[model samples]
Target chain A: MSYSDLYRNAMEKATARDAWKAETIEKITAMQSSHKKNTSVRHICFTAFRHSMVPLASAALIALMFFYSKNDFLSPSLSDSSNNTPYVAAFSANDTASIQEQTAPIGRSRSIAIFPNIVEAPTPEQALPSDSCSLDDAVVSTEQYDQAVALLEAQLMEQSQDGTLPVVLTKSDIVAQGYFSANDTISVVFALPATSMGENLYYVYEIPLI
Target chain B: MEAILSPADAVEVYGNMVFRAAFGIVKSQQDAEDIAQDVFFSLVRTNPRFSSAEHQKAWLLRCTFNRCNSYFRSAWHRHTTSLEDYHNLPFTPEETYVLDTVAKLPVKYRQVIYLHYIEGYSTAEIAQLLHRNQNTILSQLSRARTHLKTSLKGDF
Candidate 1:
């Protein structure tokens, strides 16, 4: 017999089981179902995650902004001092010890007006009550403060040139925080020791030099 | 509206051809059946578009060759093996000897012989399907015929 003839006869005797068709169909069905289930779940999760991304990022950004404004990125020195300890502000460059000493009572007042321009140059007598002042109430005009400073300067210059205000600058503890030029005179913002000035606090004695 | 032979029908039609081709190379019915199932499973899974049924047949035959070769190269095939290639087929002595001698032929030669003689593919067509040179396939077929003729003595 020929090789093909023999191979054909042998293959006829060694037939494949008919169960293979059913088995293949079953496997294909199971795989399709599993693939569909996995894909659906993964698709839904991915969709949800993509949708929520913007809102989540916005919330995180707002939270970070809040924290950043409140604590200035959590600077070590500020965090330590802000913890009910009081707000410390540096005044005179060399008078650090006294500024720190004064800082303790300033936070307790919150209305004592740490910033010189906090008031409309209100006389220390017309100073607002400790709880009545707000940092955002109204802006203090630089011109108004300068005018009040100028008035004080003229008085000091007139009295000092005639040597009538001899005790005005008798104390060696006076320190100038800042100075500015106006009207051909230097307006010096001199901080005299409260004890030397015979006053406890809240006085702006601007002296002008001729 | 529907193809005469759907992708699923490929199994029913070409299942025996793939099985027999694998059987010729591996010389085991169980392995041949496994290789056929894998080939058809790939067909059903991919559902690849073919220009013609002959294209699909050629693709299946190519997959059969790869699957059979992979079986031989598999670590499982390497480490553990059947000591005897016992067919246990109900065949006449002559048919069995012919099959045994063909099985003993190198896989390339066996593939060429089976495709040419049994599957009725020409040398050039076999070369195209196997991705081999036509002259190389012709040489292998010639050598395979000589070996079979020697193994079967004058009977071949």
Candidate 2:
């Protein structure tokens, strides 16, 4: 047979063998159905928690931003109209009171909701020292962080008038160690371990003593 | 103008075409199948609208070309494919000779050759499908034909 004919015959056979089967098409259809499924009810704040380490890394970064945030929410330059990434949302959350009002208290992040009050670019002599807060060398290791945060959690547990503090302590390490000197109190960030399986998520607390 | 195909219909109709084009580029049955799956996954994910059946075909072919490039660049594209298994297929001597010669061409040449010769796409259409310049497509086709002619003892 001719060159085109011979190649065409073999190519057709291979192509036929490799072609999509009914089962594959059904799978694609099922995938399409799932990809198109609308889950509008759940608040979509899991972008930071996409990876296990991501939450820890993000918490450390958030603590950093809380420490040194310029408090320039209204600066047209920092948050441009085009930059719509989650980073911008986080920066903007620290930048504006109104956006924090609307978006804080979102999902479990209960994450950054507490930031606006404390992290809104503090002055050197502010009543609360939110601006100086960070996961500094005080938290030399996870071991040190657990000890510091555990002490703070225990202290805060005693001070709660109602059982509002979710301080059910599991071994899951809390996030970045940040603290501030309030006029009469010392505040710290800690993890209230999930009540069941032994993974901890980030939480906040105020311990008045040293 | 034929009716535009739904994404599922497009996969059914064009899966072989996508696989063959991907095979021509990647030179592996497994890699070609993977590229085809990735192409259809994006197609299903996007559910992009097309104007006609021709548009859908062109879109699938374009997606195949793109997926082949990205997946080939990916680390999974280790060049350990053994084409000795292809010989086990029931090909006549001439067909086997043609397949081997065609596969021996450089990947770019092989791509244009299969699209132009076996799939009956014009160099212009192939250029558009492969997203290379028309001149580049023509040059590759010329070199491929010359190589095939020499390899096939002037049969091409």
Candidate 3:
């Protein structure tokens, strides 16, 4: 026989396994019911995920930035107590009205002495002294500031017309002036409108004797 | 134009053809069968629209070519397997001798020889299928024919 005839006959004789063919048929039949197979679904999902990668990363980065900035602003000042305010720690349910009363004159009487009419308040050892409020005096830690803020926030929220805290809090609104000489206490000078609509007021809080 | 073959029909009709083409290059029954399955599965997955029965056949052949190339390039196919076991292939002694001689040829020569001699693809058609110049295929075919003639001198 010729080389061509021999090659053709041999090539034609090769056959596939019967079981494999049956398995392939079964798989193809399954495809009729599942128009979208796992492989195709994976391919589509992978392509979409690939294309949206940039936007997803960008959104994550923006969220991270917001988190860090919020933390930085709200971070308690453990390093510089002299320059920090003492009144944030002085918050008490009994002193709310007195604080509001002292603060009533802020927008009108910027030069008036603060905390004059404070009721049942302990005086600090030295007002505006070089050494200021300490956590030892306030009995509050920097980590607990969130709880403190939440309490203060809720109080302010009730007085607020819209019942929402201001989005931004600046250093000008709350300040720790000094430790008073009367009772080894520190005083916080606060001046701000209760809400955006309320009048700006001034209040001095002598850090409670606790 | 003939109706396009369904996945099952295509496998039944072209499975042997694809296997032979794949085996000509890879020279392994296992690899050839795998390549054939891949070709048919791809058809089932894509369900490609073809102009005619010849178009479908050409598409399957092209897929077989690509799949064989991929198999050859894989790390698993790095070591060459012996063809001694293949001596007992399902063919007469003379036919098996011819198949073995064809399998021993280099891949490029084997590819062109199989397409030209066994599949009856013209040199021009193979050039189009393989994206090569017609003259290159013609040259490869000539060299392959000479090598086969030299190896199986008395048979030729």
Candidate 4:
């Protein structure tokens, strides 16, 4: 037989092949029913998850904002010691000057009224003499000494407006003093000290300034 | 009254087309049934939008072909007896030995032969369906014919 005749016979045989009958159709329909139900449930779950994405993101954002605001409120107290170091230095300077001026002997029986404005300036370590004197005794009254210390604290706070009191160093000054090398490229290094959290615990930060 | 077709009506219309397409590949009643059910289940789950009946038919054919290719590659195929073995069994041999031989050819050759003869699809149409160049499909069809002629020489 020719090739065309052979191909024609093949087509007839393929077309005449047995197909699925009633019983098999019933089984397949049943399988499809279960599959349809399962697929519907899966689609519902996927859609619900997709819809919840926005609200979930918003809730996370709100939580982040609350945490940041609470931290903002507590920030000043943690930083107070470092921030007020300049004021403390100025107060000590005023106290030293007051002590040197009050070195003379005083008359008895008269009550020493310490005014609120009587501030004794503190002396710097370099300016203070090593010699022992009766300067401490001259301002020995407890009430007067307390009043003088309070007034001196107020004066130092006013002097700290321009931040000229050399008590606490700024970050720029620390960098400028050659404590760290300056380069064009920024880098971050993390050092993990032995601590209670874990042996492998490490703190990491990216320093944007070189 | 306006006619409202149920999901079952949609399946009945499309299911036959899917069965024909699947039967083309598997050449078995049982395998075609499984593939048809799978195609119907996929249609229901996806709820794919089709512009017309022609589009739906094309989609079913594409899906059925994919499922049949996968089934052909599966481990079950290794365990199953060949179509040649099926011919010698108790069932009446409605299909001639020549046709059976062609059906039992490797999937690539069988597909080209089936599309060319049984489906009456042009080389371009077969190329489009198989995602091959027209020239490649024509060459494949030529090779399949030569192979079939050589195989069926003694029987003819």
Which candidate ranks first by lDDT, i.e. highest? 3
* Candidate 4 local lDDT, A83-188, one digit each (tens): 1111011111111111111111121111111111112323322112222111101112223323333333333233234453223223222110000101111111
Clashing pairs in 2: none
Alpha-carbon runs more than 4 Å astray in model 2: A18-20, A38-210, B79-84
- lDDT tens string, model 1, B1-156? 334355456767877788778877888877787787777755643445787778888989988998899789767788887542435767787778778888888899989988987688999999999999999999999899889778777434
Error of 4 at A128 (Å): 81
> Which is the winner by lDDT between candidate 2 and candidate 3?
3
Which segments of model 4 are wrong by more than 4 Å? A1-210, B1-24, B83-95, B153-156
Q: Report, to 2 decimal places, the DockQ of model 1.
A: 0.11
Quality class of the docking in candidate 1, CAPRI style: incorrect
- On DockQ, the stronger of 1 and 4 is 1
The Cα error of candidate 4 at residue A101, in Å, is: 77
Position B59, candidate 3: lDDT:
88
Per-residue accuracy of model 3 over A1-210 as CA lDDT, tens digit each: 689878877777665344556656665565433333323433443233234443443344343334322322221322334433332222222222222222322121222222222223223333222333332223333322323333333333343434233423443444332222111222334444444644334344333221
Among the numbered candidates, top TM-score falls to: 2
Candidate 4 local Cα displacement, residue A25, angstroms = 5.9
DockQ of candidate 3, scored on C-alphas against the true complex (2 decimals): 0.19
DockQ of 2: 0.20
Give the alpha-carbon lDDT of every model. 0.53, 0.54, 0.55, 0.43
Chain A only: TM-score of every candidate? Answer: 0.22, 0.24, 0.23, 0.22
